[model samples]
Target: MAQSIYLGLMSGTSFDGVDGVAVQFVPGQPLQVLAASARSFEPALREALFALQTPGHNEIEREAQIANQLAHDYALTTNELLQQAALKPSQVQALGVHGQTIRHQPTLGYTRQINNPARLAELTSIDVVADFRSRDIAAGGQGAPLVCAFHAVQFGAPDETRVICNIGGISNITILAAEETTGGFDCGPGNALLDYWANLHLGTPYDTNGCFALSGKVNENLLHTLLAGHYFALPPPKSTGRELFNSAWLNIRLEKFDTLPPQDVQATLTALTAHSIARAIAQFASRCQAIYVCGGGARNPALMQMLGAALSTAGLAHATLSTTDTLGVPAQQVEACAFAWLAMRCVTRAPGNLPSVTGAAGPRVLGALYPR
Candidate 1:
């Protein structure tokens, strides 16, 4: 039998880097993550991406240039993963690439996740499937938090409910109940504010293990003020990104506290993530027996502790805290692995989006294919 391998590439909202994974799927067997590799976007590339996120003059040309640069970087990451797995490109069936999402406005009827799938296909010598969100939006859905299907596939348990909380640039959650429809949505900022505040104060991309936040005390006043926003109260079947929860949003909130401690603000942001997520889980998955966190947040011991405490505070003391690693997939690898599985679904012409999760008109096969 042939090796059923596929490649998945993801550069989340953090604008940090690209995560690549080569996975092997076998019928009636466990998922085989053959290899995984990551590469940070160049500083210049990161700056360009951040700039292009909003709007500017001459953006058309600059956006194209940046897209080209991204293709080059993505190609490098893909080749590295292939090398790590000691496999050739021809052996891999297809590559699923979640390009950099510069603007995500589902309400406005469009969301742009930029990537040159044609170029990626040419460079990698493999079939490519990208642009997976537009169809869902056209079908009147949020076209986001697309991992719920993957969460159901990978984490669903027959006896107990499971929640997959992925804290990336923005945090999202997936509920897996054996008898109910799987669903998820973006809760709010995850590492976005934490990373921004850290870079502002420490000149680092992110606070290492949330150390800076751990050193500070949570300011209840700021926490309450931040929590007062209607975003959290609007309920699920919703999604968000840097567009609403970026530095500008933070500055507007910070304006009221003229003399607040910077580290305290970071602590409050972390608390906000914890509280909002805990609240969502409590409301949506009250019967959940386990909460498995993934993505970059899993690496932050301080944030994890806060999340556990918040869950206990929400009367979910019976719930256990764990990472996706405990279930045979590493935290960082889950998203990439999800894309790989999604690509497999695409080629198989199987529906990928879950209507209960995205609120789309109905199930549809996501992503456009770029043949090799």
Candidate 2:
């Protein structure tokens, strides 16, 4: 039998760019990437997205336009990938479109991502699989950390424990235990809070390789205050995002400190992310034998060093996905690749959600299919 091909598209919280990956999955073999492409969100669109993250005046109309614009942008991205690979829409099985997430309030039983998959299919003439979160949320789950199944397929080994830590706009970890154990959940803020601080204080989109953070000193008191949030104490199967850790959240913490250097603030924010992520791994994923870091945060050297230092302090060894010599798949493309895998699963009528990861009542098939 021939392998099936699917395209996955993702615009994560980092708002850095859109990643699209073409994946071929053989029925009984590991998934392989055929081609991949990424295009940064244009400045205007990115600004609009960032604006929506806060309490804005044009919330309703802006959100509706964002949905339409995202679908159009997704179609353009898919078309570019197809053109580059010399593949026609009919040649692929489906496109997994993880629309740009504007709000992911899964606790309310709905997560709003701003892409119309049906419109994407209509424009691109490809079957689209989207809105993968609702099913899990409906089944009494967090509807996040959905990549656990994908992590299992890619990193799960028969004899060794593995941890897949994704440091996207929001960080999450999937623990693939030797045979008896398998679970995952959002660790804490990934690039969200750091990016928020950078944009506010430095007037830049991000710190760019942790340069700003490296120049500053860590504020222990601010770090302690940031860590005191209720979300940090929440047990596994819980998830959070900009909604909880946005500018307002940061201001509340800043109010406690009379004054501080901007770089120091950056340093403390960086520490918050690294420390919270490390703490989660220690508390929930201590048994895992290896930790593989991915997502945008993987690119920040200072954050990685802090994470390594924390792991060492906890008496745990750490390594990144690059260390395993698996950089064939770009860190940015992993989430997008997972969506492609999810599309294939939907087509095969397979369950994509891991009950252990999402705290779901049971295994559930995910995603809504939109026919071309």
The best candidate in terms of lDDT: 1
Runs of candidate 1 with Cα error greater than 4 angstroms are: 1-3
How close to the true structure is residue 79 of candidate 2, measured as C-alpha lDDT? 89
In model 2, which regions exceed 4 Å deviation? 54-58, 318-328
Candidate 2 versus the native: TM-score? 0.95
Each model's lDDT comes to 0.91, 0.84
Candidate 2 lDDT: 0.84
Question: What are the per-residue Cα lDDT tens digits for candidate 1 across 149-208?
Answer: 988888888998899999999999999988888879998989999999999999989989
- TM accuracy, model 1: 0.98
Q: List the lowest-lDDT window of 10 residues for candidate 1.
A: 1-10
